[model samples]
Target: MAKPWFRVKRFGYGAGLPCAWQGWVVLAAHLALLIAASALLTGRPLPLSIVVITSTLGVVWIAWKTSDAPWRWRDGGED
Candidate 1:
């Protein structure tokens, strides 16, 4: 029989590695900020323009910096 807490612990949200998760989290935060900035600046719904520009820059930055392969990346899936 498996312990109840074990299941909960193993199945916890965002089971991936910390470093990998950190990168994703940072990216998400940056995107959200840009989206919010656009919405606030443009005073329009969705704010896709800022999202696009911010996304482009974010992606490029990640892609270039991550190419070294030294960056710690958490697994997308739980162990």
Candidate 2:
């Protein structure tokens, strides 16, 4: 199988920072989209909310799919 782009967080219930360039690109693009959406959708609460929520879900889905391990609560113990 291909190497994962993200590593599971040691003390959280989700993926951590990017472990590969591809992951970094994904993160950067997501952030850029959010910023652009906020700037363009200012004063439009409904559209802004929809864009933010959809972008968030898209990022989460990408992270989950590219993570090295399944997400779960962690106490910093060896897995």
Q: Which runs of model 1 end up more than 4 angstroms from their true locations?
A: 1-19, 43-51, 68-79
lDDT of 2 at 59: 86
Q: What is the C-alpha lDDT of each candidate?
A: 0.49, 0.92
Instruction: Indicate the worst ten consecutive residues by lDDT in candidate 1.
Output: 1-10
Give the Cα error of residue 57 in candidate 2, in Å.
0.7
What tens-digit string does per-residue lDDT give for candidate 1 at 1-79?
A: 1111111113333222224554566567777887677767675545666566767787656544443232343444543
TM-score of each: 0.38, 0.93
Backbone clash count for every predicted candidate, in the order shown: 1, 0
Could you give me the TM-score of model 2 versus the true structure?
0.93
The weakest ten consecutive residues by lDDT in model 2 span 1-10
TM-score of 1: 0.38
Highest TM-score among the candidates is held by which one? 2
In model 1, pairs of residues that clash are 20-74
Question: Per-residue lDDT of 1-79 in model 2, one digit per residue for the tens?
Answer: 3989999999979999999999999989989998999999989999999998998898899999999999999999999
